[model samples]
Target: MPLAVWFVAVVAVSFALAYLNSSGWFWIGAGAVVLLAGLGSGAFPMDLFLVLSAIFALCSVVLGVSPLRRLLVSRSLLAWYRGQLPAMSQTEQEAIDAGTVWWDGDLFSGRPDWGKLLAVPRPKLTPEEQSFLDGETEQLCAMVNDWETTQVYQDLPPHAWQFIKDKGFLGMIIPKKYGGKEFSATLHSQVIQKLGTRCSAATVHVMVPNSLGPAELLLHYGTEEQKNYYLPRLAKGLEIPCFGLTNPHAGSDAAAIPDFGIVCKGMWEGREVLGMRVTWEKRYITLGPISTLLGLAFRLHDPDHLLGSREDIGITCALVRTDTPGVNIGRRHNPLNAVFQNGPNWGKDVFMPLDWIIGGPKMAGQGWRMLMECLAAGRSISLPSSGTGYAKLAARATGAYARVRSQFKTPIGKFEGIEEA
Candidate 1:
């Protein structure tokens, strides 16, 4: 390129970098423009340009051949950009709060403790657990003959639902003492993974209750009386549970949910008691249509300071029966043709006793933290397992197809591109 063209190119790059709000890139471009201008004005020899070109080429080679590119891009450049950016969203902050930071150091210099990583316990299923998984696997495969054809209907067949309940698939995460299988996290993931390979819809049906459902919340936070009343029923599949967390206004910002409850006297079980009158509108609730019980989260308010001096007690979680008066359920949403019973549920003036709180009155105002903690574990196990199952299924089917499918009188698998895939 001519000297004038080089000068214009450098000036254009500087403006582009400034437009992108990249201060670092703008400075680099400005430095290059100054060098080019000096060379064009005959202030620097042609040999100087040759020397600079060689230096740039050597730097490029070093960056391409070593880990220096990633070190600069990810660790240095990206880290600096992140520092200048706005604070992370509440969901991201909560996830970080829920997570553990074991070691702290730079990426390149950090030494991970291999012993600690290897010592992490693996999940083992007992004889009964293994037998249950095998039986359920066979049962699911038989019921879900063709997942594509099954999607023609609105939902899973009645027999399929009955089979799931009868097999105790909904209560896998609950404790054995509570009449549940209480399978380990590893076993729970494995069961979901295996089921997902056969039918994605069936996996959701079985995975929901074992994941972020009332069974988990009640087990972790329910009072003894609450446990006695609900655990056995949940274990026996007498109750199908769904949690109400995501609302139309609050997709991921659980802390900012507008659905609320007011402290007041309310009728419960045909008697008056100091309870909450909750008003909520939630969408994207999994199993909202068929769930017999709804695990609801809402901000608790006390206009008259009924609970205490504090007017607002932050976010609270409660268990509301779907049959409760003023509660509207049964709205369905179809996402990606998955047969999961997901939809919106709303209530005008739903009333429940104060004891209906998951951990009872004492656990009020702790719902956000509780939900985050549960999510930390669920996020690590359930979805990742299902995703892995799908990947494995895709790999198997693709490999088989590549082996048999012909292209140019030869198996497609023989192609370099096909082999790379």
Candidate 2:
């Protein structure tokens, strides 16, 4: 964290790299000589000096001992290190494998390759994406008023809400055949940013469905039948969807959810069927209050060993109609007076057919992995884009207020304190 410590670490790495390549002895000669001269100077602070000394000492052992150096890279050493660790939970391992490790792996390795960072491809908008941004996106922003959306109507005007659905704004990520725009994630973020500048409520409304909702999960892990039935409906806004991962007790720690389902026989449409009686209490669901379809995450248990010998099937995701028996989808959460729909929903002993599972019976217990994988786009694109939008609005508002508001017959922006700010 300290500059001096970073400096020493970089130098130590330099020395280690020198020993690894050709002209290694000359590296030992010139770099080591210069390093020793600096250490002899005693100009650094005491704490920094100690750190430098410790690093140099470490470099000595690492470069001096051939066997020690070999052991550091040996597979046996890696295995031993792994064996000493505690068993990883599904959530822990899923989180670690969520996104790509390109830059993170390089930085953590202690010998970063600069070229790899420079080689990453850039993201740009396609012509259709640009045109849509200039056209429908702009029109949508013009149609919605932030004050009216939040305060007057307590939600986006009905016309604007319909416009959002009809325009396929919520279906940006869905494929074309599924009645969605199939836009790139970059375009999705851009759309959010533009809408965010005009209306915070609209930004969230569009963001939730495009991000980690039923559509995304279905796209990644849904069975062919599920995809065929749901994707088009979602893309066409026939169904408003919300995902319930955060329960009353588990918000940020989604994997620690206490909600559960028992896999057993059940009645469905006047017939006996193998399914689950799911019980969940989820709060802070972004669109729960008005969602026609709900995406639920809960631990699945097999006490009767119906599917296999395993008792715990880990976390499973399933699709449930809000109209399903025993489902309680009502009430609302007014977050910061924002008009976007958000609320709590829970169910008690609701029976769900096995086919309702996102990927059917075969993919039960893989819900956490699907969530983590889909989380990458939300983290990188949707949330940040809204933040970017608001940031741009803040800067513009600040500048305009400074120029228009006056103090003693002069613009407030001309004042010393205001100018400094």
Q: Candidate 2 lDDT (Cα, whole model)?
A: 0.87
lDDT of model 1, residue 184: 83
lDDT per model vs. reference: 0.80, 0.87
lDDT of 2 by residue, 1-421 (tens): 4456646865886777666764545555555564555555654566766786678668766765678766765557788899999999767887777757668688887889989888888888999999999999999999996878877899899999999999999899999998999999889999999998999999999999999899999999999999999999999999999999988787846679999999999889999999999999999889899999999999999999999998998899999999998999868989788778999999999999888999999998888888888877788899999999999998889999999999899999999998998
> Top lDDT: which candidate number?
2
**lDDT by residue for model 1 (151-246), tens:** 565677778888888878888888889888888887888888887777777777888888888888887888999999898888888999989999
Candidate 1 pairs with clashing backbones = none
Q: How far is candidate 2 from the true structure (C-alpha RMSD, Å)?
A: 6.6
Which residue ranges in model 2 land beyond 4 Å of their true spot? 1-84, 104-122
Q: Model 2, 224: alpha-carbon shift in Å? A: 0.7
Q: Candidate 1 regions off by >4 Å?
A: 1-111, 145-149
